[model samples]
Target chain A: MLSVAEIINLLNSIPVGYKSPEDNCFNAANQMYIPEYKKLGVITVANELQDNLPEADENDLFCDVPGCQIAFENSASYQAHFYNVHRYLCSVCRRCLPTAHLLCLHILECHDSYFIIRAKRGDAMYSCFLGECKVKLPTPKQRREHCINKHKFPANYRFEQLCGKPYKRHTKKPSKSVEANEIVDDMDVVADIPNMK
Target chain B: MEVDPDEPKTSPSTSRSPTQHIRDRNRQVAQQHREEQRAKTIDTVRFGLGEVQEEVEELDELSEQDINGLITRITRRKHASAEEMHKLSEAFLQSMDNIKLFFEAPGALQVIVKEIIGLDSGCQVGALECLCNLSLGEAPVCEKIIHQGGRNLVQCLDSPDERLKRTSLWIIANTISTSPKAAQTVVQMNIVPKLFYIYLDDSGEKNIANEFREDAAVCLQILVMGKNRAARQEDITFIKDNMIKKCRNSVAAEYHLKIIFHADIVNPRNEFNIEQTHHLMDFILGNLYTTPDFGSIANRLRIVYAIRVLSNMVQCVPTTTIDAMRQQLRGVWETHLEVLLNKVFDFGEDLLSLEVVYLIRNLIHDKSPQPLPCQLDRLEVPNIDYEKLLPQEWK
Candidate 1:
């Protein structure tokens, strides 16, 4: 059902003389008239206004995730989508954000997602990092920090650099330091210089 | 060949039934008899010199029918077996007189040398030994044998079998020693490293390996000493840096010093590291008495070259540089001078008399701050058993 404000906003967008009795489809509560359509009352004018309003852009109405592109086909559908998909109810906008908000939050909160070592299995996903490393975030930045601190990957940005293969991704880990004896002996040609010392 | 009673009878009068069985049994018996005859003929044919010579003449003078029969007989003798091949090469060497005639027989000896080297059998050693003796005796023909498929000898140097490599080194050394001109072809082939590796491999004290090392060192020493200055420079540096120093990596220090006794000590100007030259001298003086006199010529000449070069260098280099040379040679002068002096006075009695007199004359004539006199207290004269000594004034 259209809210009172949405109905009024739709009517205000049109010129005064555009509606007629035959143009009315939905029976609206409020009506207005101009000289061109005096016979048309609230139902005709409201339906004409509803039909004249431009369609909402698909991207603007839908959340960014793959399956939610047509979540808000109607006001009731939008409400149900927010309630069911996002489980979020926005008090100020009078909009329920459910699964759609879940996706938006996933994207916003974890910038480090790009660096997350993920293995996509059909519709499901799993983290490939070894050992008790179950953590998820929306963006690559947060996920990268999470990987470095939690997973013992190299904390440096170089470790996070892409390996240029999608299947074999990076979870940044620190390289071990050269052994003391090896530094002194096998690396004589490389480390013996005064600068290296 | 006594007939066995068990032999199947194939006569038409006997056994009409199972004729196929009887025929099969007869064929097996005939085949066994033929095999025994072949083994016997291979054993009896003499490959010795007079016999082989007669055979060669026969080969040359035979009627076409006789030649066919001779080929058929030799074909029956399998040269593939180790015992057969060894005996055959021994026979070939015994028939060394006939080998000379085959030199002109288009690839005869080359084929034999190649076959010897090519086979899995151990006849290569005997075959090479025969070639070594022949080359040493007949200098003119060594090049032909070596040039015609003698390169298989070098390939033997890289063989994983140490014995094969050792024998190859000996044959190659003997081949080069037979004629100095052969060194050009041998060096062009870059065989210097292979020879050095075998000379340095200490895995075997086996007589063959030891002999190979000694003979090769001696031959390389002489070849490097050839009067060609460019060859001398390249060859000497090659021996010092590549062969002598590389041996240190594989050989015991003592054995390293032992092989160092073989390095050629030709024109030693400023080419070698002065310190290395001193170290080499010390090695020579250490082995002067201990090393056998026959193979020690290269070591002896190396020492003399060091002494002569040090002597000559003082006159050429500035006074400041002379101090460095002296510092480098301090090890030799301190440690081994007395032993070298003894060898000079003793075994070199006959050889050094005229050279020493000439050296003394040059010493008196060529004076540049008079190079330090060979210190007397550091010298010891060993007994000169084989060499004749000069008179007191001449000494």
Candidate 2:
């Protein structure tokens, strides 16, 4: 147990963190290591060494997959869950992963993420990058091949970011003034930005 | 709430087929029956007079002499049965006004407090149990219990007996939950520091005995829970929307929420202010005593609970809350950040680690604060990829 004096020393050692950072993405200027953090580092090392404590009985909690009949303790729950749940199941190849946490990683690295559509039914099912398109392929390259050969969808339309649900593109409204201007060769300043296209 | 720390590891004695054991069971039941009857009589005499249903309302109806007499009669007994005390305290809770009257009675509180500190662990635990039961939500009674030398409940925290420590911590938590005033009173007693001191007294492995520390965290939660603007916002909404749903036409929820949180709705007995978040931080950090868990799993749960309480405090406080808290102490954010990320890396899918991340995010980025949600909602990720959403710069 940390003694009163040691605890005081520890507290005194750690600088109160930066109150705020102005930079958006991430500012490494805000991150710093101190002696207190090293103490925490020691704690983590000890945590790893002492990590073998028996787990609490979680047999009662079922997998979060909707309609899943698997309680955590069910013999096949862990082993069969990949195929049991679509989130863990690679839709085209039918390969399964163990956990939802890993499923995203697996799909991103292995499967066809091009048609990245989420079918939120019993378990999360990742589809080909061209959302709502019927062509389900084992890999992104396969989906791209199928899209090129079979579908007339735009090349950019067939592509989507694979991670963190990529980005949701809401419908864009054509402005009435812009529509009238479109009768002419409308030059918008916003369109001048290369990425705006 | 789920862990029944009091439950025996082994089942109570049971045997069928043996006549001797059957007789022993019968005898024990009969003895218990006699005690219950005695407890019932004592309860009836003190509060059952002048219409039993209104006995709670009419507790002060007992002459001072009668109250004193009842106190003397109950105190003189060498061993007060815990069941009987539970029964009496349960009855006392019904008319909390009478509980105040009972405690305020010439010498009754002193007797109970004395017995609580007495050498007999059973008596001490029993008194704490009765007190905890009596003051569960009754603010006035709880206030009286704490101010009337009941703050001495801290003594029980130091006792060698685990049962006594548990019950005493529970009683302190119960009173703290009574209202913001009770919370302020308990915290002002430097309860957070005192508890940490006792918790680390063993000075061995940094394991916080869950039986004790979990409740200690709970007490800290109470100290901070209803004190913040969000809690008050939620409180006002709850009181108006749910507390007096039927009485909406008659009594405004705002009036009631203010009245209840401020003190008694009708009779604002004592002005009770919620303990400030900065003040709590001072206690938590200044007296922040801890034993190194050196990494025990049980200790991990304790850390999770402790961080949860801290996160709750963070959620309750405003952005300026951290600024004020930082004036008093530094390193809460970074210290927690290290511990939190470490746990997250060590134990993926840890809900507590997720909360700590948010707290760190809030502290690090100074994000525009959102309205605090209910406690359970805090555990879930805003989206499944919340982990991926974390800054890539994070180690």
Candidate 3:
């Protein structure tokens, strides 16, 4: 279980979203627990929200990131170097997230509407967790087939249904109120949970 | 009608007869009629002059009243409706004197600019048109418009209404055309990118009319083509960085290349760095190699622009840069030169042939160590029919 101080710290770091900070932390943790949501893919978000990556100079082709002494003669090589050497990308939204923890935070803050709509539909969501593959299937059989045929995942790879019930249960809560008393109530509930991670 | 003294001697042969008496009486009657006719003509002239003088005085008073009314209407705190503003703009367009009077009014430009920013799109279009006419006045008037509301005019370039955008571009074009100082003032406002975006509206939707694009292109050309060195440099840099760099491969490449060519004519010596020179060489060479459909006038024009840009690059770009580019693009250059020579000798487009000839001349004059792809000495000059090439009036 998270200590009170740790929960308070997590609450302070929640970024732009409609949910309370505690709820955001809870949702981010839940998203992190799902394996398929951790895979990175092409960015499909707004350019404004994309990681502020520096562009390679047309002639010089040098990385402008601080403390990096890397350079290349061509743009393609420079792009490849940057892609491989730096930055973690959010798998669900394909946004570049700086760290694993921020990726978790981004998932909950940015994809709240997606999760809510899915939970409202009460449908099972299956996605390929393999390298940069964003294929989502409706059933375990199709997912397993996709993983085996497309990604070359071993047949014995265990496929679990990604989170559907947790979002559905949370959907019933009244999300409009962010009163202090309600947050304390949330804190109490969070404290009661045995496995915080 | 008066009897001459010599008439009596000529008539001495004829005795004082009844015929002479009748002639004298008849002549006196004719003289009396003539006097009456002259008196009538004088009276008519005096009457017409009086009417014309009165009408002129009335017209002067009416025009003065009309100008004052227009100035008052424009300077009002409350914005004029679209119809009223349109009528006022039309009235101002009738004469430069009215435009002068309207602008000379206290706070008239400020009020019009306010209406442009604060009114509905329809009204804003009218106000913009009014400003467009106002900018068509003397240089001082254009300077006043730029000093008063240049930023608002630039903002109107982004208006959703096509007329509003076009009128804004027209105003800017007029302002820049008046004097270099006015053009520099407008350039300092950072309007190049806005005008360029309007020119190259890449959005698949045809929201921007061709006329608006033409006006925007004119404004951009004037801004870059001005003799003001600082303003031209600012505008050229904006076009190179924001427009040309972003849309080098798009369909608008021809237009961007034309702007660069025009800007290059007034370019300061050795302003382009080595990298920029190389980039330009590659771009110009690439366009030169790309064959266009000769049947399409638009495509032919694109080639003309490309060749002209290549000529500018040859002339203005540093010698070392040119040498390096020549070495790197030798094969492409050879093909391009062959195509240009063929166009000159065979295609018979007077303008295109002339530009190619100029490009060849520039190449020869550069005098690099490497030999030109084609032999100028062996090449036969095509006999161009000057009469056929001349314009109809010239012919």
Between the candidate structures 1 and 2, which one is better when assessed by TM-score? 1
TM-score of 1: 0.42
Model 3 misplacement above 4 A: A1-197, B1-64, B74-78, B160-162, B197-201, B205-213, B229-235, B246-253, B265-305, B315-336, B345-355, B377-380, B384-395
For candidate 3, write residues A81-165 as lDDT tens digits: 4543345444553444323443443354345666435533544444444323456665445766885565443354333212111
Off by over 4 Å in 1: A1-197, B1-84, B116-119, B123-130, B133-137, B202-210, B228-233, B243-269, B284-350, B353-366, B369-395
Q: State the C-alpha lDDT per candidate.
A: 0.39, 0.40, 0.50
- The i-RMS of every model, in angstroms, reads 59.9, 30.2, 39.3
Per prediction, the TM-score for chain B is: 0.57, 0.41, 0.65
lDDT of 2: 0.40
How do the residues B30-106 of candidate 2 rate in per-residue lDDT, one tens digit apiece? Answer: 65445533432332222221233453443224444554555566666643454445444544545444465566656
Query: Best to worst by lDDT, what's the order?
Result: 3, 2, 1
Q: Which number leads on TM-score?
A: 3
Candidate 2 error regions (>4 Å):
A1-197, B1-72, B75-86, B90-106, B201-210, B224-395
RMSD values for the candidates in order, in angstroms, are 44.2, 31.9, 34.4
TM-score of each: 0.42, 0.31, 0.47
Please report the candidate that would top lDDT against the real structure: 3
| Tens-place lDDT digits, model 1, residues A15-37 | 22211112231112012111110
Tens-digit lDDT track of model 3 for B200-261? 77555332232566567667666665234434555566666654343445444555555665
TM-score of chain A of each: 0.18, 0.19, 0.25
Fnat of candidates, each listed: 0.00, 0.01, 0.00
